[model samples]
Target: MAGVPEGPEAEMLAPNLAYQEGFGRVFLVCAAGRTGERMRDAPRERLGDTPEQERGIVRDEPGETNRIRPARLAAVEED
Candidate 1:
């Protein structure tokens, strides 16, 4: 193809679509929707994690609160 990036076609996802890429393949992921925040963080009116054991970093916290769960890093197939 002309002027297209010379590599595998990288997929651009729609909003709220869960996915991860490793090596050359991408996998779609969905949370169990359990007793905690979303894969990223709580609602703006988030749950007071101080009131519970947090699954990962709370972005609302003071630091790199980019919390990631097992589903966020599952089955990391290396190149």
Candidate 2:
């Protein structure tokens, strides 16, 4: 998962490993209000998934991510 490193021990390396192994695309979770522990744990939880499951998890995340649009962009689109 592509969580920004929030603390010193955050598990950024796992995503790089996942990418190298071709399990799925980089999982970019939104780190809006999450703590380092949660961010680190999220990717680790998915480590057990098959590639297909990983793909679905990664694919579905973006829909939730997309809902957090900027107000200015939303206003512009309305215009």
lDDT of 1 by residue, 2-65 (tens): 7544322212231112222211123222334433334333232223333233333332342322
Question: Lowest summed lDDT over 10 consecutive residues: which window, candidate 2?
Answer: 3-12
Which pairs of residues collide in model 1? none
- Steric clash pairs (candidate 2): 2-27
Q: State TM-scores per candidate.
A: 0.15, 0.58
Each model's lDDT:
0.31, 0.67
Query: In model 2, which regions exceed 4 Å deviation?
Result: 1-10, 14-24, 71-79
Q: After aligning candidate 2 to the native by TM-score, how far in Å is the CA of 28 from where it should be? A: 2.3
Error of 1 at 44 (Å): 22
- Candidate 1, superposed: residue stretches over 4 Å from native: 1-21, 34-38, 41-79
